[model samples]
Target: MGHAADRRPGTRVDRMMTVPAAVSRSDRASATREAILNAAERLFAEEGLFAVSNRRVSEAAGQGNNAAVGYHFGTKTDLVRAIAHRHNGPIERTRARMVAEVGETDDTRAWLACMVRPVTDHLADLGRPTWFARFSVQAMADPGYHRLMAEESLSSSSLRRALHGLQASTPHLTREVGEERREMFRHLVLNVCAVRERELAEGEPTRWPTWDDTATGLIDALYGLMTAPMTPIGTIRR
Candidate 1:
């Protein structure tokens, strides 16, 4: 009779019911971490990274325990890195696909498009009132936290590939000048997106009606910047 019970359909149902206890605990923990990340990102974006405390993030996340941020992410730096990692994965994947589609092209605009669109597209997909662009600008603006953003970007092979292609397409630039323009490009994208994000969040009118339009305008500007002739150093008025 016990052997017969073990073979019954009801016995399988009983075994399945036992799994939810551990799964539920895990799901709850995951949900808590997500809430904390979302809260931390918004606070850090709006109030500046150093100005916001772990305790504040905890409360903002609706966690009764003030130590929740530390409990899940170890330190504030760790929490910031976690936030970066969460968004970086999707952005990187998008860039990789774009890179693959464009292949090894000498087209500067194509490479620049690959660089700019992934970020704007990701922001667009995230819908209105997204915090990541502002959060990224804040992170990059901080001397201590700037390396975190650089490291996250340098880790992406797709970004590296796109940059290499962009540089290769512009054979006229000296290595020094190329590096300078690269820095300018980075700042332009970051600040533009951050401003657009702020406008959207605050219900203000935007320069571009949509993220795609913004990307198009950015790519055009970048193309001109990249292809523009450099002034001769001997002709300087200074």
Candidate 2:
């Protein structure tokens, strides 16, 4: 049914050749997979997603076998999903904890802080030279793979609760308005973080002193955007 399933179950490229008792072989295979993921993520961030191929990812990952990415992950979309999965669990857990602390608040800033901090915190937890934020921006720039990030890990219970809390802060927001604002919010958070991540990676100074401070700035901006006065003036007169 799935893309990988469309191929035969035990193809040479897809199968592991090592014996079962060789736990070290399993360890090496895992390390190879992680290398491929890291290289693919960096390539997807620096270059465009579709611009780079599985072979290129393999080479960048230092895999002698060009089919390494394919063998490990099936398709390009599957690789993207894998990358998102790496980041999503920690992000969701961080958000869930923050949400618990901020419970049932009607404040837009509180909700916005909930939305922004989890991502910043995750990146902070990763230390220097992280690629995920840039990788995320590029992924979202493409229409075909943009939704993978959400479906893979971002659409969690905590995310839904955060959005609902935001919505509660703006009772009169129409569905269309909410959709438009969500798009804007997504662009702001992803791009800003990408810029900051890039700067941090390059040893350049950030506008804010820390990731938490950057998150605080984003919280302010998001709160303003979500609560801004919407207007088209009076209705069109006939």
Provide the TM-score for each candidate, comma-separated: 0.91, 0.87
Each prediction's RMSD to truth:
3.6, 9.2
| Model 1 residue 205 CA deviation in Å | 0.7
Alpha carbon lDDT of residue 163, candidate 2?
A: 86
Measured on C-alpha atoms, candidate 2 has an lDDT of 0.88
lDDT of 1 at 180: 91
Q: Which number leads on lDDT?
A: 1
What is the lDDT, from 0 to 100, of the residue 195 in candidate 1?
Answer: 97
- Note the residue pairs that clash in candidate 2: none
lDDT of 2 by residue, 1-238 (tens): 5465323446653354434536787888899999999999999999979799999999999999999999999999999989998898998898899899998778888888888999999999999899999999999888888778767644689999998898888876787888789889989999999999999999998899899999998888888888886775486845
Worst 10 residues of 1 by lDDT: 1-10
lDDT of residue 181 for candidate 2: 96
Candidate 1's displacement at residue 200, Å, is 0.8
